[model samples]
Target: MIDPILPFSSYSEEINSMLPETIQKELVFLIDSDFMDWKKIESILKKFPSISHSIVRRRLDVDFGRLSRRLTGKSIGVALSGGGAKGFAHLGLLKCFEENEIPVDMISGTSAGAIMGGLFAMGLDSSDILPLIRNFWLDRNLLGDFTFPFVSLVRGKRYSQAIHEFFKDRSIETLPIPFYAIACNLTKAERKVFDRGLLWKAVRSSTSIPGIFPPFAERGELFVDGGLLDNLPGSILKERGAGILISVDLGGGGQIDKDEMYHNLLGPHYLGEAPSFFNLLFHHLKRKL
Candidate 1:
């Protein structure tokens, strides 16, 4: 019941400190940046055989590569490589776990790593704050003069209202800019899929579907909320099978209330380019178990 975040190297030590000694030997998984050597990871795993360990390295590079490729058509094929390159690493780890029949005790991290961990828990894609903001700006052009400044200010604010205010101020400053990606409701099918827990798994698998325009709608209930789908192309929404699209604010923010439609923002602190948040998040997940 310790709520430690994951991905930092010291996570193991922290978990050891927090948990009862008898339960300290449980298996753990640490997914983080590709800085640590596999040997080191092996050594750590060996130290706690009862606690198997794994890492998904090069996480950000993978996401950035995917995003960059999407933004710039030149790298489309590479970018579309599902969850970016890091996703492949994650899959490889998952494959290993599957082959070995290893059960993940916990997963954690900030930003992408945190997102994946959250997805593992909630069975959905954790909202990417930067992408959400970028998409918002792309659709509205409201943050023309305030993009960077607004991001800086909002990074520290974790409360839902504070984030709403930030968006409101940006809207007021920009004028006539509509919020394009806010979900007002979940379709009946979407609600049913979400209730069944198939929505998130579909999204994760859909990433691997081949095609220049992979049908997101056909992929089942996307883990996005109604607003996100609204912003997406019409064709994409129509093809959905059972994927649930949770509200942007709810998913991005770490608020864990399953009943609430909204959640806090993930904040810039977690999204900053610095590697610390990633490391910290991963560390927290690996050791906490």
Candidate 2:
């Protein structure tokens, strides 16, 4: 009944005529950005055109809004941080929330935090995801940008594909709760939000740890990890109107050892000689390696 890859061109004429001016403009953006193909948009439009159409259903639906208000009536936001495998610590944190009967209204994440946040937004229990991560081997999952780099052992699209398998036919907007990834544009030294397009693409961008995983492109913009700009994204959740914020720390602080920074004495791809300022700073930052 629903297909994510359905092409929009199939019913283009029918939809273009019916959609309002504002929605048409939005759809144009989605189509142009490769976020939603024409067909998938058509499928959604055909089923759920507007809130006006769902009014009858809304009337018949149980007014859980009243029940929700009766029970504390507050929104809680969860913020997750990036730390590669260190992010697994969030499972224990999320479990604590579950045991405490705290509810999550929205989620914001960066880097590996994006993976955990995305799955949770898709309605997967933290317990359900634990086994998946435990069985996952980082080296076997993704192959990086080029074959020559040891990073080539990181297979990005494969990870994206596996995520699609678990979160089939769901994009960012379709998730049960509002979820977003913070990604940094290395070229601009700016922080950006991944709210549109493929959830995996955004997750990939958020998790793209510069030299570790290659940059991801979305709508013609390149994005690396959000940690580059806002490593701790507590402020991001606050901006999103979180009534209360719960932060799960999966990060560490330690002294950087310069000797371990060099890989085979090649200076981590000879980045010291690179022209970009980011590359230069990257070399220094990798001192902690």
Candidate 3:
């Protein structure tokens, strides 16, 4: 059975008339920006200049079943990997899924991935989430607490607060879709999968980097970034009952060996004055981290 979407014509005129000219222009500019390409940009550009509510309605009221893939009774899961800011790419992937009318049955993620997955599971699609992040959340002053060079650079108080505010007391078990967030137990040196409890706390714990953000503490246990243990949480998606898995690994290549790291640093001109002092320093730091 197919779920029907509200017809584009139903509210198109009312919505268009309600928007101010300046706000509409800003939205146009944002869509035209070079950072993103949705594969239908050319079509949008060609039609938008002289667009009409009736034309948009006609264009949208198509036989969607013919254009989209048939809904097979298979569980499709997406597993997102952690790589700090690179996790934002998950938004683009989600947008693609939305465009193609592919339904996401389950999602599992670590670190930054957890944030995106959690938001989606809460019922916000890519279109709703991108604007929220750009216009509000990303603009906040998150560096409210700094710490001496010890276990972490910052106490993460402001960041945690920001997450809590964004979630608005939502719990994991209450989400529309099944979601899993991966974190790590620092004391036990093991992975922790969170499928329930406060959404913000799980996201905070998932993204708590060891030397960057202080480990999150709950009930006598210390939790740090899930990337330390499971950067790509595809296996969890499988274990939970997904037949088809789509894993997005933004971490690029796996860990580099010490020799490769040095070789890449030196480049072709190996007039090596016995590897730079900073190279040895970074190597040691990498091992410690």
Q: Give the number of the best model, judged by lDDT.
A: 3
TM-score of 3: 0.64
Q: What is the lDDT of candidate 1?
A: 0.27
Inter-residue clash pairs, candidate 2 = 6-39, 7-38, 7-39, 8-38, 8-39, 142-154, 142-155, 143-154, 143-155, 144-154
Could you give candidate 1's per-residue lDDT for residues 193-215 as a string of tens digits? 11111222223222211111112
- CA-lDDT, candidates in order: 0.27, 0.58, 0.66
lDDT of 2 by residue, 204-256 (tens): 78877655565776667778777665555667767755667777656432111
Candidate 3: residue pairs that collide: none
Local error of candidate 2 at residue 68 (angstroms)? 4.6
Order the numbered candidates by lDDT, best leading: 3, 2, 1
* TM-score against native, each model: 0.19, 0.63, 0.64
TM-score, ranked from best to worst: 3, 2, 1
lDDT tens digits, residue span 68-92, model 3: 2212325678998887777789999
Superposing all C-alpha atoms, what RMSD in Å does each candidate have to the true structure?
Answer: 23.2, 9.2, 15.9
10 residues in a row with least lDDT, candidate 3? 52-61
